[model samples]
Target: MISQNTISQVFETARVEEVIGDFVQLKKAGSNFKGLSPFSDERTPSFMVSPVKQIWKDFSTGKGGNAVTFLMEHEHFTYPEAIKYLAKKYNIEVEETQRTDEEKARADERESLYLVSEFANTYFQNVLHKTDQGKAIGLSYFKERGFTEDTIKKFQLGYALDEWQAFTDEALKKGYNIEFLEKTGLTIVKENKRFDRFKGRVMFPIHSMSGRILGFGGRILGNDKKAAKYLNSPESDIYHKSKVLYGLYFAKQTIAKQDNCYLVEGYTDVIQFYQTGIKNVVSSSGTALTPEQIRLINRLTNNITVLFDGDEAGIRASLRGIDLILEQGMNVKVCMFPDGEDPDSFAKSNTLTDLSDYLTEHAKDFIQFKASLLARESKNDPIKKAETIRDIVNSISKIPDQIKREVYIQECSKIMDISEEVLFSTLAQIHKKDYQDANKKYRQEQKAFEVVKNEEYAKPKVDVQYELERKIIEILMLYGDRTEQFEDLVLKEDEVSGDLIMEPTIQKARVFEKIYLDLQEDEMMFSNEKFRELYYSIIDKLNQEEEFSTRDFINQLDQDAASTITGILMEDEKYGIDDWERYQILPKKKTDTLDQLVSQTVLSLRCFLIENKVEELKNNILKDNVDTKTIMEDVKDYNDLKSLLSKKLGKVIGSYVTK
Candidate 1:
């Protein structure tokens, strides 16, 4: 619970572009900025940031929101985490309010695990810097690897003592629950005994995209033949290795800044690259690359240069990743080191310029790389060559952009020495089959959705009456800034004259709030719940503003409403611009049209409310003749009311509104 002043400052001072730019490489596109989608693999830019609107939209995924939402989505941050992120980004001091005991009790178990993991990270880092064993072993190992003191601290490399129960003991001493530590895999719990999970290993903390410690990866030192060379934290609430890339927390900025990422297969590979002046590098940590892992990288940059040890298995693994990367709409380029070399050895053996130059000269597109690698074995074997061609075509089809896919297919035809027409035909067949399957599934789902939607209520037609009301509401929301000349009666008492004088002053009242208050007084409920909520929300916004701009209104609205408002404002009308000029767009026809729409919407809502009330009345119907007569009188009066509603609603509700 941050202070109100702090929250305001965070919102005010935190520029959307500035905050988002820290994570995204944004280039100016007109009044906005366009970048590769951070949420999806994209070659061409689909992520648009409107600096003016202070909002971002990812056209690839159809996800858009204000700055807070970008943090929440891209970083997987909770609402509080997003707020805190912004607060930290803007350097606003957070003043948390006291939480009740019940809230503390209800704090989630997953968060507790996160807390424990975080605590463990801090403890390990402290050990590395503070303790003799940590400095001599962990710090010494990192320094020996040519990592600078700053780099060591930046990556938070740490150490765990060889002594059993050292980490567990300290954590428990600090009042951390051992159960959570076990759950988070920070401690190994065997029967009733608990010991430090990464004991005697050089610690490498794994972080979530938002930089929270999710788990650890430790490298065993000395003659620990009984221990695995590298042990990673087991699956926990916060740690998902398949999705988490090592060094991403540090490399995200550099990757985004350079608009490209260097992918490696080990932690040391990442360290070596960073040490050798390539800051935008991350590792798969010796695991087979996952779609989730690729997606994680996809969120930061579109161009990926996969650096692999020049081994057959490494090349095969890298080939496997290329298709996944292509499927994500990312541009994939392969850069293999010399035979028997890895990123670690290669970077260390050469200067940064030499290493970078080698990568630039050697990098090849996936299709070309795969063809060259496979052709030697497949040559003169038509079946093998055909299979190879199909594999290349399959990879080409995985590309999201049709043009890019076609281009790849053409390139494959040239490389494989196959006909372009044949490859294009094959692609068409695959695409057609895929589309049909997808279309059939989508239609089946659509049919099922329709059945469910129709089960509770009959099919709805255009609700003419409600449409009128909605139209009026939209008018109020859109043109609410129209200042009408109104005379204000001011009573002023003058001491010198000893007389009170009545003076008339012209004042402008905002129509939006006026309509809003008027509707509130009448208890107006629109037929559509969403529209009703939106109506009230728009009114609330207007009330908060001194002068309302439709653009401002749209800016504050949710995406759907904003789009709807844009549609309404942008829609071209066939009827009258000359008429609009004379009427100030509020002539009888337009006003009557809007007024009619609004009246109809209100009437429909009123009818629904009245029917509900009637149901309640009927539920209580019973007893004496006097009571019966009163009920009958009320019913008769309601029938007359219905007739009046029908008459009033019938004119404008002719047929456009939808329920």
Candidate 2:
């Protein structure tokens, strides 16, 4: 467990925008920062971070919280892991209790796998630097590859000793469980016998975007004719190779800053570029590109420059992957080295200035490169030439933006010497077929579910009572200590008509006092347990503290309560300033109409609950042996109160009428 004092220091020191800025690219929007939602695939910016509030909200996904919650949501970190991450980022010393053996045994399996993988990373690094055999073999190989000591240590490159049990034995002696070792694929166990998976190989630890060591990719140094040269950790709970981009942990901020990402094919390609001072590059680790990996980059930037080996035979096949990049609506360019050169070797030979210039000069628009390459293949064959044009058109259609698609189509027409009309027709045909297929799928789904599409399967009813209670909580959190003028509705007997009429009486009280007294008078409690807990906690803090800081208050609560309060507090900052300006929408604060806002919320809650009580009475009257007179009288009294409440909230959304 992390000590409360250390957690407080982390919360006090870590800026929400600064911590999140490491992973997300944010631009200033008035007093806040806006960026693309890291939790969802989106083109427009919907994620908002408020520096003043010390909170963030992803409008697209409706996930909002402080810095710690962002880590928990984005990285799937345990609460303690997030606190530790923030502590490290802010350079705060974290005070933690030692985990006992019983606690360790009951810990999460995924966390155990993380522990085992981390231990393996540390062990491998020790072997590479401390052992004579490792220095002579693994260190020499890295040095031969032109990697500096700083770069080697920065990437945490390491080696596993040649002996089969070298790693397994050391790990076992250290109290690392064999089950987790096998699960992380660091060790292979068969019939209780263990062997190091990457024996005799140099290790490159693969990390998640949050810098957790997920697995390893090892390169065998010596000539083994039958063994595969490069081996990766088997797909484990903690690592998915297809979804992991090599060097992203180190490259994320740079990619966002550069407004572009350099795509290479191997780990060395990324390291070589990064070592040479180009920090905005990542590799696919020699696997085929995946949409998940592309979306990861999408969270950072929308432009990619793919660096291909000059002599690669599969360059044409790799073009399919670049098309996936296009499908994500990104601007993609292709660059090639001189024949026989890959990014690693080319960067190694050229000066940094020369390398940067070469990349800038050689990078071609993906369409232009595709057109030139395919046209060369067509030569004098008319049929192949027509097919090349169609292929180019299909790639253009994958772009989600119509303007970009049209622009690329024009470029294709000019490059291929084909008329724009022909290309546009082909693009239209592809879109039409896509629409038809989608429509057919929708029709099939509707037909399959038609029998179940009765009133029972209709849209779920919105819970109005919950909303009313939520509004009360929102008011208490936002303006609890502040005094507001309220209008109390008092039922008075009309002297002439003898009918009860509501008379308004002006009163002044703190927001919390008004809400507490109203709830106490009604003898009501929040039906939602989370809301009930938060309501009392907020009231207690307000009454006791001299100064109530929302950020400090959030820091003291548990995860669920903090997230709920943060969501309510920062909900108004969802739209970027540019959006507000463009839409010409000026927002009115709840404080501006505090009198009506507070009264309306309380009255609405009363009206809703009264209707529910009346409903119960009606249900009781229907039973065979119930006394109808007393129940009818109770229902009549509820209706009278509801009618008075209705007169207050009838004009707004709080109207809760009878069934």
Candidate 3:
């Protein structure tokens, strides 16, 4: 259990924008900031952050929350984990009770696996830096490969001791369960005895997006002819081979800043590039690039430059990954190093500027690269060349961007010497077929889902009435404390000393005060759970500030709250700077656009409530006919509502209009 004092301290000191900015590249959008959605793959930004409100929302996903909620959603963190994450981020001390043995035992399996992986990482680093053999062997090997001491430490490069039980024994003695070790693939267990999985090998820890160690990649250092050159931790709950990209934890911020990613194929390649001053780079670690990995990078930036070895086999194996990237709506370029030159070796020998310039000058779009590679093989053969063009066009059609697809089509036609019309026609046929298949599948899924829902119970209509009322509450929450100067009518109570002093008529004067007091007098509290949470948060902020700006609303609020407030403030309603502008712009005559929207929303909800009350009144009247006074009171209440509506609507919009 976290202490209340610690929670309060975290809430007080933690800034929403600062915490979210570490993961997202937020740019100023009006009073708030907007960026590409981290929850989904998107080419254009749909995620927004508001610092003042201390919330974030992804319009694409419809997920909104405070800072802790954002972390819990984005990183799949437990409540405690999210709090600890924020505490670590803001440099606040987390004061919490120690977990009991039962609590530890009941913890998530994935978290246990992550713990094992972290243990293995720390053990490996200790062996490499502290043990003589590890230093002499593994450290020397990394240094020989041109890895500097800082680079080695930064990447947490380490070597497992040659003895099989060295890591397993230490982990067991430290109270790390041997079962978790085997589950995380950190230890190979046999006959109830565990042995280190990467014995006598150099270790490369694989980390999740939030930088928790998930697994390891090991390279054999000995001259064992039968041994594989490298081995990776078996895919475990915490480490999915397809989704994990090495170095993302270190490179995410740099990638967002650079607005591009340098994609390589190995752990060493990532480290070497980083050592050479190219920071926005990550590795697929020789696994076939997956859409999950591509989306991870897409969350940071839209552009990806795939660096592959110039070997024929290497290029062929990697061609398929480019289409995978394209399917995710990312802009991909290919940079092939010279034969026998991998990114690791290439970066080791060249300066950052030279390598960057070479990559810039030589990188080609996937279509051109594919065409060039295949055209060489299909030279002088019309049928094979046509087949090659179709293949290139197929990849081109996967692009979601129409302009990008068209540009690629033109380039493919020019390269293959085919007419642009022919290539486009081929692309259209392929795209139409794919789209139809996808739509059919989607419709079938929807039908199946509806059948299930209808059989169970039809979903309740989204409480739009409740939501509209909530929006009104949100507006009150945001501006409730603001000093709104209004010309209020007041009557003078006393007359100055004079023989014939006369009482003056009522006078109107501008009075300035907070909205909270007004709402208090009316006896209203924000009635939505999320809105109520935000209301108290705003009150806390208001207490801390002399004057508040909307910028503060976004920047100070949790990322999820900020996102919601941005959507609420910017959506549906039209803005009016001048009173006359409202008349000029609004389509309705009863009131200006903004007021019309507000009134329509409020009245629709109020009518629903009033109708429900009327039904209840009729039920009461039916149950007891002697209660004429009660019936008359209900009738008088309904009349008062109608009169109020008449004043508001300028004329009665309902059937019960009374002049």
Task: Summarize candidate 2's per-residue lDDT along 289-321 as a digit string, tens digits.
Answer: 999899889878889999988655678879999
TM-score for each of the candidates: 0.73, 0.92, 0.81
- In candidate 3, position 193 carries an lDDT of 72
Top model number, lDDT: 2
Model 2 CA deviation exceeding 4 Å by range: 59-62, 439-451, 455-459, 489-505, 575-578, 622-633, 647-659
lDDT tens readout by residue for model 1, 498-586: 78655546555555644555357447566677667777777777677777665445545654665455434422221221234445554
Which residue pairs in candidate 2 collide?
A: none
On the 0 to 100 scale, the lDDT of residue 302 in model 2 is 87
**Candidate 3: which stretches are off by over 4 Å?**
1-13, 90-108, 439-464, 485-608, 624-629, 648-659
* Candidate 1 stretches greater than 4 Å from native: 20-66, 69-79, 97-103, 379-384, 422-509, 517-523, 526-659
| Residue 364 C-alpha lDDT in model 2 | 99
Ranking by TM-score: 2, 3, 1
**What's the CA error at residue 79 for candidate 3, in Å?**
3.8
**Please, what are the lDDT tens digits per residue for candidate 3 over residues 1-659?**
78777776776777767667767777765456777788886777777766656666677787766677777787788877877877887788989888788987788977777777877888899999999999999999999999999998999999999897988899989999878888888888889776777878999988877778878899999999887789999987778888889999999999988899999988999999999999999999888888888888887788999998878887888889999899888888998898889899999999999988989998988777899999998999999998899889988888888998999888887888889999889988998999899999999888876544363356557776558656654554445444422322223335554343223232222111233343344244545777767656666666766665554465456555665666565442212112234355543432223223333444545555555566777777767446868776986797666445434444223311331
lDDT of 1: 0.75
